[model samples]
Target chain A: MQHPVSEGVLQRPLEFTLDFFGVGEHHLRAMPLSSPTAVINAAAASTNRIKLSTAVTVLSTDDPIRVFQQLATASALAPGRIELVAGRGSSTITFPLFDYDERDYDMLYASKLALLMAVNTDESPTFDGPHRNRPLRDLTIVPRPEEPLKIWLGTGGSPNSVHRAAELGLPMFLGILGGTPEYWARYGHVYRDAWAQAGHPAEKADIAVAVHGFVAESGDRARATYLDYEHRMMADGAAELGRPVPARTDRAAALGAGGMVFVGDPNEIADRILHLHGLLGHTRQILQMDVGGMPQRDFLRGIELLGTKVLPQIRAELGTP
Target chain B: MQHPVSEGVLQRPLEFTLDFFGVGEHHLRAMPLSSPTAVINAAAASTNRIKLSTAVTVLSTDDPIRVFQQLATASALAPGRIELVAGRGSSTITFPLFDYDERDYDMLYASKLALLMAVNTDESPTFDGPHRNRPLRDLTIVPRPEEPLKIWLGTGGSPNSVHRAAELGLPMFLGILGGTPEYWARYGHVYRDAWAQAGHPAEKADIAVAVHGFVAESGDRARATYLDYEHRMMADGAAELGRPVPARTDRAAALGAGGMVFVGDPNEIADRILHLHGLLGHTRQILQMDVGGMPQRDFLRGIELLGTKVLPQIRAELGTP
Candidate 1:
């Protein structure tokens, strides 16, 4: 994978080698990795075992049929290894750029999500919605996957979004940028409760969490490195988007077990992950290690530590494969 | 490359090995290779030397910025090796499927083509057109290509399209499905005349030709093989699209030197290609060897002959690299 650290922003390749432990996904945030399907498809050509996905494919501004076709084509290259996480993007940049109105954000997301799911499951799907200029009657989105794509509803802590995912019987992916692990666990309960209310099986209600953090050889290095980069990332991102710089979180408090940021050595990080897993009962946890132009070596060392140190401890303690 | 013959329609990979001689492209017809950028990106991951392209991306129904981003992303995978051929598609399947009205076909193409060109050159572009829900004011399409993508104006012999390409200073890709070399040569003259009249340098007026063809060990074998599949393809496509089967062209006449089809042995095919080149002065010639349900072996053999025999002969005779 040609990492963004090598090519600069907006050209980052999603490194799916993390699929050895779990799936690796790239989200469309600000100006980076905007063409997630294209990057995943390119990565699909070379990697065999890794599962790749779009963490959040800004669904509101995109054509569902086009997204379905791109993912389906990528699946052809790497069968059974493609997944999609559709979200009303956290960033509103796409609405203006794609000629959509921000006022219709939720409405657009709901309409497009229905169409995306319909196209995934039906060979000839008929759908009518405000999102489309005209109703699609029995249109076949071509290059259907041999297996239907596994779609996750991505949300940034919206109760309505969680309920919609449950109602639709999709996996819920939580994008947790801030808040304590205990605080974030409430969304998982809400999702599962809604899933059951919607008459879905208990086993089917899956939840995944993504957080901003890093791991290093020592707790001191990890905390210091992550704090420096995370703060810079917030400021740089805000500046890039012409938004006000966000207030920085307390470094010591955030790195504590009560907070969401997961920076620490392998042992400490593993313990925190397990604690969060117990509270949320989530299916997966992804760490955003590289932020704010962090050097490749530091980011890679974090992944190495997560894989070689963190995962084994978590698996051993959980008594799972 | 995960050829569709190996998987099945709409799942075909655009084979780019032809770039040893020139670029390889896939066109979106009724249902085959519809997501060209995804396939190209996947192919780009494995191949180093082959130039990949969408011969005719149905630009009328697609968002130009999205198309640009997808192609730009693919270009990052294989820098300086991605090309886009934009056309008002020959098939009308996409319009209804994408919720586009066929009444605005030419208008949509012209508007989108302008935006595509604008984004390719300018980092921030402003535009207004009937095609857009709202006018774009200086929107920066993300991940601009390191090098501007080679955009070819694809036309199935439309005079207005030829003029547009010339006036825009873009290369013209003539999709010559059927026409005698002598007759098709007029388009080249027209394109060059307009290009020069529009004040573009003479050498920059490039013309590329794509035609239905097949090459076998013998002229009789090639003609019979291509005819059988071509007939089946035409009938199948018509039935699939619910259009009337097109009137069959005279087989002998089509296979003859004065005809467009280039079916024959390598020696005969080479001679015919040279004959066409003499008339058209085209920079690139791509043969559509696989049609209908032609076996993979036949397609591979045709490509093998084109690379090993036809290209070598043509290159030697032309005395140009």
Candidate 2:
């Protein structure tokens, strides 16, 4: 049983990013892990405190009942520590891969999210979604979690996604690829306002941020090291999506103060997190440290610095015990 | 990560039994495990040599693509050690729970099995099964295994199941709940004959057996301990199925030579296994030791005896290294 220190994940851990963005080839080359919930179950067996989630489950292409069942079983292994971050996926590859029509994306996500929420809340739920041939009439989903699982709506900051998440009273997990703290903060405010308007408690309208990042002994080293890997990832990813690759200068700009990428030294990364927290007021901020098949030594070092150096500084700044 | 020795599974392991036979209540009470492939992934993280499989993955109601993906991920965790035993589930509860008609059982299993086999063989399979709304035209499945997975057709000795398994050229996993060696051997021969008629190689026509069993220091003590639990399991299971409970006299008869339940001392269990092997010519035999909410201590001890005492005897009798 490897610890997050030995494996991955620092504090409030979110691991095993599942996506359809060149997932068949490039991502497979980048990481050995596959099938998020199953991987989390294995991680659940080893860890005691770190919250495990399927970073972003492509909920649009997956069966929500099976997802719930898998997560519920993982929760049994590590009770009260399992979570789910579902997304309608940024890539269109999954629809055809899973035999789903791309045209039904919105309907698919909406209906599946509804079913997932229903199954999460009730063991015996009757769902008549378009995905199913017949209505499930009070069918029991076994091995219910000890408590209701914390489900987050993972979004790339589309207005519909934010409003839908808020309306459903689900927490928001903002995935920031390239955007300033101020830019992301607007979505947070919109989500909270919509959540309150939808009659959900203000306290329950929680938010978390996910971003591309790395940390090293110095800011220059961190940025320099992450630059090539991030560029390669972007180039390969763009090619997969049949889009023009962004220039290295644009990638570098994303690592700047007004940018989204959070690469820097420990102190710099900590300050960046604090700044984001002040703007977004998010409870958690998880970094994608090992993007584009970065070396394990660098990735592990980044995680070590984040946990030991960066997180403590953020906690101190936030007045958290 | 817990080894099979520490957690469960003495030699060849089949942990995490997923069945909807009163699964919502009774089975949850009996086992902490749920969702076979997910649990197997957790087990895969720890063990290397001991093979892990989802003991009879209820295939009829499940999405074969998802199952393949999950199993393939586990294969990544423990390459060449992950296998799948897909069964058209004995219980009918999964059908309603997963939003499928029980009337479509034959069609569902047959079609899903076809898709699973195709995905196992080809990474980009074009499947147009009845279960799917549209055809998957050479859609690529990610993280292909280094080798094609060993898929066994799990059955309770139905003629149709036997023929289907043989016709598909899949290995047979005969599940013996209550049948004599001679009675079960007839199905093995039928399967082998069909395999030959189907033009499959004789060497590749492998068969494995599963039975309710326990091992103890003495034959009387083994039977005495297993009797109440097996009877209780049968009673609860029968009640779940809306069938009359088998009499204790009948269960006791099953523990005897001419019956299916293999319960006795190490020597007694070994002899029974050998006798059955001689009749059936199976490659492997797995026991359902912990049945009817049996105590962990007893189950653990049974596994210990099986690994240390019984397996050695079988090996010696078979003259294997």
Candidate 3:
């Protein structure tokens, strides 16, 4: 008797809402940053089964206490449905305005993560570091959620960040935009190996990959729309990195075509995801359906299709439970 | 009609709840140094109407991000009721556990506070400090409260802390269990004057004092309880400072007799508060009703009496509308 291999699927679809505050567009009217409470409440009301997360909350320039409290509150409000994916967000505006030196990014993230993890524990922590000291007090954080909050470190193609997350026993969220799945294989290996060496339990290291996705009724339409959106996004990202936006269409196409973007129908998109998963061993995949001037309605429709059609089919094929 | 010269009583009853997660006791528990979130949450919820604070959250030894996030979340939940009254919390446990050098206290607070305040602003902040760095991005803190969150510097009779708070336009909450109210007056003046000179509005330089408060149905019971609590607290404080608890019964008697503690009724407590207000010029006062395992029932009763009877009289006398 031949047995079919089970393809991996998330127990249920995890719902994550990208902040509506449009980024990278000069013409876009900046929306107010949504409150953590507002985001958590909205996510809670929208889906009963999806895991809610902030794509990446900037940690380097933020107060750890506030972040912990907000996340904890959200966790309490939605029990096991919330997780915080934090990063030294890609913005220098928070630094100069807050009067922080730009060189301490790595140290800041390290220290902040350490402290954040400590404070979430059951004991009253007394840390005396280069930045803080305090006597031991019987401290308690209020409105704690039912489950321990999961923290994922979001890294923009940084190996050190991946290793650090492993060292800290935190999950890793890798940004794979503008890169091929083959590029992330090394990071995945490093993370898994580090977790093993650290003696953490098996499955302690979780890896998630984020990719830009655009699906349409027809392949040609999807490709065209994806190219348009990709061009604009690449230009903005390049400019933000202080690099000139590539003027040549060939260069733009080259950058987007093989990168972690899926511009096709259900089967094609699913194949791309499976290929990346095979390479990176990532259980969680975040698809950015809306990017760089993509119409909101189209984006929503794409997401709906991905959730209702593509994801289920992929799960069955992959034999994911 | 000619009105007689009447002094305006300022009864700014600022209730501060400092969670002293007894470092020694927590260490004894064989748990990690982090304080339990439940305790903090309970305290925050319990003191809903008061100025909820961590007397000195001891930032030097902890992660600023966690500290800020936790407090910010609490503040958002409570709106204007929360204040992160942080200090270089006393205790060396965080140093070894978190691998911190003792010399980094000043740098840590300054950098952390700068980062915290920057993130709290409407604009994306930028900073290039020795301890941290980030490029400008369209970053904004999610879930900011409607009212501005207050950050108070908890000072251990340190003039530098007072000046720092003043210079930064932040408030100061002084812990004054051992010193005379007169000692804080000089610091208070410096803070106010510095704040004014720093281009802050006149109303920005607020000062709060945290003191021990004990009230009883009878003067004798109050005195006995005050003596016991004060003795143990002073002894513990002295031990922490590497000094002997002072053999000064006369001073204790004077304080008790003069209404610093061991007070009779609501009226008497109110009168003592008025006197302290005159001496310290503190607009907000946090009274420590529970000291050294004082019976929970007694503590609750004292709180009720103060909130219902004592506060009303004091507010009325102060013409607080």
| Top DockQ prediction, candidate number | 1
Ranking of models by lDDT: 1, 2, 3
- Pairs in clash, predicted candidate 2: A1-B1
User: Compared with the true structure, what per-residue lDDT tens digits does model 3 show for residues B2-97?
Assistant: 000000001122231222211111211212123322123323332345445556666665544444444444454455665566676655544544
Best by lDDT: 1
The complex in candidate 1 yields a DockQ of 0.51
Docking class of 1: medium
Per-residue error (Å), model 2, residue B282? 0.2
Model 2's chain A TM-score stands at 0.90
* lDDT of candidate 1 over A122-200, digit per residue (tens): 8788899888878987455777788999999998898799889999999988888778887888878888899999999
Model 3 chain B scores worst on lDDT over the 10 consecutive residues at B1-10
Interface RMSD in angstroms for candidate 3 = 18.4
lDDT tens per residue, model 2, A1-321 = 122322444322333221111111112223434477867766766556667787788888888988888888777777788889889887786777677889989898999999999989887677888877778764557668889888889899899999999999998988888778898888889999999999998998899888988889989977877878887876776665556877767577788888899999988899898888889899888788777768777887776777778877877888985
Question: Comparing 1 and 3 by lDDT, which wins?
Answer: 1
Candidate 3, CAPRI quality class derived from DockQ: incorrect
